[model samples]
Target: MSESTPSFVSLLWGTLFLRPYVFIFLAAYLCLATRHLGLGPTLLYLLLGYGIAWTSEFCSIHTGIPYGLYMYIPATHSQELWVLGVPLMDSLSYVFLSYASYSLALFLLAPLPRSPVSGHPVNTGRYNLATLLLAVVLFVTLDIIIDPLALRGYRWFLGQIYGYPEAGIYFGIPLSNFVGWFVVGLVMVAVLQRLSHWSVPFPWLSWGQSRSTNDGYLGAGLYLGILLFNLILTFYIGETLLGLVGLFIYLPFTTLAILVRCHPGFKAN
Candidate 1:
């Protein structure tokens, strides 16, 4: 074996041990963003996430998958604060995720429900406060659906604190994790929306060159693609049918929720 092979294996082993949840988060991000962002951006995000995940291997913070399957071993403090356990790549994942979700919302779910909560009919425009709030809410809801399953095993990095196996159960999820997912997620989205100049009109995919592309096809494709790919990847990597079942159960309800939320006056008797 080459000199680097052992270290690489060790790093992978440590990541699995220390930050197991990274895999689930990474996988989920890949699946969602791939379907939504497609080609160039999708590949870019994947490489970015991989690099971040790789760097996190040296940090003081630990993350793992499957509760205990993998772990992140921290390098000595002399390596510099960011390099120790925080891996540059892992930090980068947040940027990618925040941008991906924000763009996806604008493209697929934004101009949201003419007032998602109070149901006040309003005009659709660019980046209004209300629009931003709705975007955050949508991202949080997606995180909520994901955390219960994600935190059960893979969740949180070492020293960071949130959703550990020992303490078990924080607001119906491992305690540390629920807070992390919600708080971090909210903050990330806020930063990306407020500070960044990276906005683009969607139907990021080329075929989406018309009104139907934005209005229906791209969104439909995202949902379907997520549903299919998640099922397959979850089964293959995790080797369990439960992931497939969860995806099947979620797609319909999620679709219904999206439809109801989008169509303001469509209340059923």
Candidate 2:
């Protein structure tokens, strides 16, 4: 078959696969995740909670490194191309972590309540700006860890845009590989923030909520899983444990730092 051949069935499947249904599913999940925590705004967190993760997945596809593993998995007469070892699900973590960070930041800052763009009638002056910003930051941070790992052979690069056929390293990271991640991450975040303006019901969800145990735990779990999964892959499949350990250390510290900054008056010391 020619590459130009377009199958109606395939198109249909793809459309269904990329439909808005998952966003709805994500919103539902957010409610559950934040129900116990007393966080600021559950609904606002939903958009970044899902959109950022989606953005990360999209980033990995184009860059072919960072947040994904190059495993030769068994496919239908082919190998499964995954970004990290965890498949597409890893992208979803971008959303959860971004949301977690946004919520944590808000909780600590005690910012005014904003409303979702959808005009969901937020009680305070809520805005989705924080969520959007944090989403971008988290994605970039993931890449920072990934670029060096790929150069060190902890993660495999599917395509050689630069470097010495995967044997060379610049500052412990392949120049081409790092460039790819930075460019992709920057562009993706810009696009997603615009998309959120249109699709999100309330902008405040991005910046309107408080920190809660729920957000913290969910963020911790999502990141912890990513860290462990990468470590396991490092031992059995590759050598990306450095990135995993970095994440294990960085994520908790970030959450703690935000907490400390927000509630400076309270001191156990």
Candidate 3:
């Protein structure tokens, strides 16, 4: 490894040590994804997610296509690994975030059973247009909570890593940023939906048999975990107004989810 670039071992250790919370969420994703989607598909999602997210960031910084115009500060370049000016962890985050959102969408929209003996609540294992659209919305909603707080990363442990050229209407983040998230989320979830169909040959690579019926809950929980994590940080950093805005935005969705989850009619037979 060069002086500026750290070895994989060092990068992994540094990420684990510095961003343990990220790893916590990531570990949950790994277990839940491996169990429900099988190891092969889970690994493919990570690889594809990282590629798309990194490219989006790179493009946004240069041509301002998908995520609006923003630039990384490169303040952590020496301390952490950066791929072409974007932090490796920054792009890597989208993998879990997208998966969490996609899984939650499945939990909400799929024919979920309150209880099942042999399969997940989202037992259909099929993707439709509604699920795809809902997954995209859910994925973008995550950024609604995440990006605002992240913009103020200097106030917390995240540090000042990136910023927009101009101040945005909602918490200093531009509207185009969200539009960009929507586009990326749509593409990523759509890719995942396509991948869900392929059959893996290696039995050892598939975890479908050992998965719990409650695995869908775990997947949705990951989404909530990430949302709660950022909201808590927003409050912890004294951004009470911003945090409240996030709660207000999500309150209706949360209530809707609860109502849908509890309604006897919504539960599958």
Candidate 4:
């Protein structure tokens, strides 16, 4: 409305799209996800993920039922965009995190049967109970590293943007926060499954399909990419012990996901 007021496009770009790693992850997800779902569905995916993350944060901040009593602490001199006291970039990051986790679950649990109609080893059962459950677990495992490092944002460049009134058990993070992540992560994957029509079979890969199956290589890469970024930050902030813990927690699982994905004999279907 005002001449100096930034447009929505500029705000989104400046607040989220311009960030170095966030921008890279967002771009990597779009490129990787589109290979399977195409551009249209990918757009829907982004919308669904953003909606679930923002809504959950809004609810938890107000009610304290899920994520506990945490409040936004806007960093001094920071011009980042906030939606109802929640960082826009924070919500946007969930889109990639959820997608990568969901994809990894499918890679590990979902069987890719060679469709009778199409010879490609495609998956149409991503919404099955097994896949959903595994995705939820992976998402939480990620937060184990995320919450601690994020809490130290002030010591690094992320700044002090949020705080929990009550101290938590794990590095000052509440148990309810992880529980909330599981709930929110479930909703994110579940919504994408229903909207994307998970039962609809699509082109997967050839018998000699590249080792990098959508669920296997690219998905796992994104998951690791996010983890490594946080771990680097942890060390940068002088939390060597925390950084090692993060590496210990994430490296083995990431290695296994890639191994399971790349194995030609791994798919039951």
Candidate 5:
């Protein structure tokens, strides 16, 4: 098929499969989630993430409450899947992104030493309020990189899918957009955590027996993967300043995850 006259099958394939970045992340999400949470939980997480993401986009566009006033640009109108004016791939992206964030939290907030009396890991305080703050911070940190580059979607693998009703200072994205991502990210993590909590005998449910090199840490590593992916795109598109800005947030977290993974003392403590 010619570039200008691509077939409908081509568009469907492009949205779900041929888009290299999105497809790769989707595969990574499945693999990591199944490795960590088993098949049942992984499936559940996928559904929940998609539902929440689509709902939030629908609500935000209609009421301008969560994500501020914005509308999809539909630059690829007939070339991608859309439901209620939101791209299917866009909502689907949240499944992997937020799962990785929540996994990073699980790695960082893993409880202290295992109990001698019982093989079970000790329950720390209520999700450790400290962890909650850090998780949300990390989740929001992702959007700092995401929203700006997405506004420059014309330059990257991402087509121009959406835009703000009013652009703000951060590379033509509104501040409210980032706030919405943070809120939505927090909600995603919290729901997944609750689900993990309910799933009996899951590895993370142990709370204290954290593996530095296991699935939790793998999720953390994926954050760096995402950072690198965007940085490459930023460089390719000549968004040097934006690339540097992403570096500022991602590098420190990368260092921290490395330390947490390599240092024996950091395991289960």
Candidate 6:
């Protein structure tokens, strides 16, 4: 085999072994998305999401358009995978993150059935402009907690994978980064909405048969899982102030989500 072949294999396996958390979340996303959106749509979202995310990162490093200029450190290139200097896992993360955000938005915006016989109150994953925009907002909100702590990755197990040439205001992250996330979320959800209309039938790939009443909550739970993971890490690394800020930012939204679940008015048909 060629020398580059081994390196590529190593990077692919290393990315999964080194960053097990990303795959764990990805697994959750696959299950949740396939159940609600069908395997065909989920796979399409995964492929398209990765493409958009990788292209965005590739462009940002070179041209500083959407996310401004930020460079991957490539410190772990030999140990993990680096696709053109961007960590493979980094762009791959956008797939699950955007899906989780979109799932949660659907849970909140769609009308819930009052009957207990049906699955969880989250109606069929529907999309409107309001839902799409809310998903974008949620996608950006996740980064509000994630990016700051990630900047301090050197202090934790994440290692120092990337950095910005210039310092930023919010926990050393730039406003442009969030703006880029917003744009990505918007684009992703909009595309997903369009894809939902396509007739790409994959009946054999369907995994929704084992559906549970609790399935509706899984997507939102995945969102919370990621949010709490970052928040706990923020505190673990002794960033008490930053952790508190994240909590404060999420408190009202969490409250609203809870109300959406429990409120009788929201259970309207």
Regions of model 5 farther than 4 Å from truth: 1-11, 111-127, 200-213, 258-269
Higher-scoring candidate on TM-score, 1 or 2: 1
Clashes of each: 37, 34, 0, 2, 0, 0
TM-score of each: 0.44, 0.41, 0.89, 0.81, 0.82, 0.90
lDDT: worst 10-residue window of model 2? 72-81
The worst-scoring run of ten residues by lDDT in candidate 5 lies at 204-213
lDDT of each: 0.44, 0.42, 0.82, 0.75, 0.75, 0.83
Q: Report per-prediction Cα RMSD to one decimal.
A: 9.9, 9.8, 3.1, 5.1, 4.9, 3.1
lDDT of 3 by residue, 1-269 (tens): 65555787886677677777877877888888887778888888889998999999999999998988989998766667778888888888998998888888877765645345544454564478888888889898889989998899999999888998889998899999999999999899888887666687887667553445456546788998899889899999999998888899888778868877788575544
Q: Write the per-residue lDDT of candidate 4 for residues 123-163, one digit (tens) a residue.
A: 65565888888888889988999888888887977767788
Candidate 2: stretches off by over 4 Å: 1-134, 146-164, 168-172, 191-221, 231-252, 255-269
Per-residue lDDT for 269 in model 1?
19
Q: Model 1: which ten-residue window has the lowest total lDDT?
A: 208-217
Writing each residue's lDDT as its tens digit, candidate 1 over 167-229 gives 444334444443454455555555544432233445453221222223312333433343444
Put down candidate 6 lDDT per residue, 20-127, tens digits, no spaces. Answer: 999999999988877767788888889999999999999999998799899888778778887787888998899999888877887677675644666455455465
Q: Which lDDT tens digits does candidate 5 get at residues 1-269?
A: 65586676777875775366887888888777766666667777799989999999999988987978888887776676677788888899888888777768767666656778765545453255666667778878887888788888877778677787677877887788878988898888777777654555655434332332345556777866886787888888999999888887777777776776578486655
Backbone clash total, candidate 5: 0
